[model samples]
Target: MSRVGKKPIALPGGVKLQIGEELQVEGPKGKLLVPIPKGITIENKNGTVEVTRESDKYAALHGLTRALASNAIVGVSSGWTRELDIVGIGYRCDVKGNLATFTLGYSHSIEFLLPQGVDMTVDKQTHIVLKSHDRQLVGQVAAKMRALRPPDPYKNKGVRYTGEVLRKKVGKSGAGGKGK
Candidate 1:
């Protein structure tokens, strides 16, 4: 038995769940659908939902289904958020409407368009906040932003997640190493 699958997910207020061929989770924030694989069953008892597998052959699906369902429920209810910080002398970002303009120390500024269902906000010209009801979408957007200007190991400049730790690499000692 999968421990994660056996656990019950508590349904928060203002959230509605429908169990069928697929699970539909709807709440104040948004709606999400979780696919149900064969040999796996989901049930709602009272206000909690439970996932069970018919046999050990479906062990992997059992846990996966449970996690997806949980994420959907939480997403629709309270939504998700991801934060990033631009680290450089001239690196900054600005969001106007659905478009984002980034100055990541390059010769020309990069313009990125925000996808539907994802919202972005900038603070202090360096901090970026991404929000969405879909957890996966929020994570994907954050990754794309970070990839635009990945942190440099030596100078530690570029985009990075807040509170993320990086070990700065030491530069060249001098030009007199092993010189006769």
Candidate 2:
């Protein structure tokens, strides 16, 4: 038995689930659909959900199915959040409705459009908080923002996740090498 699959998921109040070819979880916040793979079965018993596999051949699916279901349950119930920070002298962010404009020391500002089910908020012009019911979508949006201006290894100037660790590369030293 898979360790994760063996554990059951407790459905909170106001949260409903439908198990079929896919699992549909609906709650106060929103709804999430999680696909059920082959050889895996999910059952809702006593307000808790359990995942089981037909045989050892479905070992991987057992854990994966459980995890996805768990995420979906939490997502619909509460939601997920991703935080990012802008690091630089002139790098800042502004949000107007569903659009975010960034000034990352570039000649022209960059505009990012927020996708459906995703909401962004800016604080102190340097902190960004993204909220969404879909965990995967929140991560993807954060990744795209980071890719816009990845942190500079030398100066560490760009957009990065909060508490993200970066190693700064040392600059070239004065001419002190073995020279004739």
Candidate 3:
């Protein structure tokens, strides 16, 4: 038996869950759907939810179901946030409504259109805050934004996650060349 699968997820106030082919969790923040895989079953008892498997063959699915359900529950209840920072002398980020304009020392500024479920805010013109009701979407959006200009190993300049540690690579020195 999976330890995570055996644990019951406590339902918070104003949150409701529906179990079917997909688990639908509705709460104050928003609603999230967690697809239920085959050989796994979910039960809602009292104020908690539990995931179970039909047999040992479904051990993986059991844990997966529980994790997805838990994420959905938490997502709908409190939502998720991902923060990013732009590092450079002239790099900056600006958010106007659903559009975000990034000036990463590029010849032309990059304009990124945010998706429906994701909301972005910029602070200090270099910090980005991405919020979403779905944890997966939050991570995906952050990754896409980071991919725009990943941190350079040698310069450590680009978009990076908050608190992300980067190792700076040493630049080459011509003094190492043989006497000419």
Q: Cα RMSD for candidate 3?
A: 1.1
Candidate 3 residue-wise lDDT, 57-114, digit = tens: 9998898889889988888889999999999999999999999999998899999999
User: Model 1, 36-130: lDDT tens per residue?
Assistant: 99999999999999999899999999999999999999899999999999999989999999999999988999999999999999999999999
The candidate that achieves the highest lDDT relative to the unseen native structure: 2
Please state the error at residue 74 of candidate 2 in Å: 0.4
Model 1 weakest lDDT span, ten residues long? 171-180
Candidate ordering by TM-score (highest first) = 1, 3, 2
RMSD of each: 1.2, 1.4, 1.1
Model 1 regions lying over 4 Å from their true place: 176-180
Name the weakest run of 10 consecutive residues (lDDT summed) in model 2. Answer: 171-180
Every model's TM-score:
0.96, 0.95, 0.96
Question: What is the C-alpha lDDT profile of model 2 across 83-135, one tens digit per residue?
Answer: 99999998999999999999998899999999999999999999999999899
Winner by TM-score between candidate 2 and candidate 1: 1
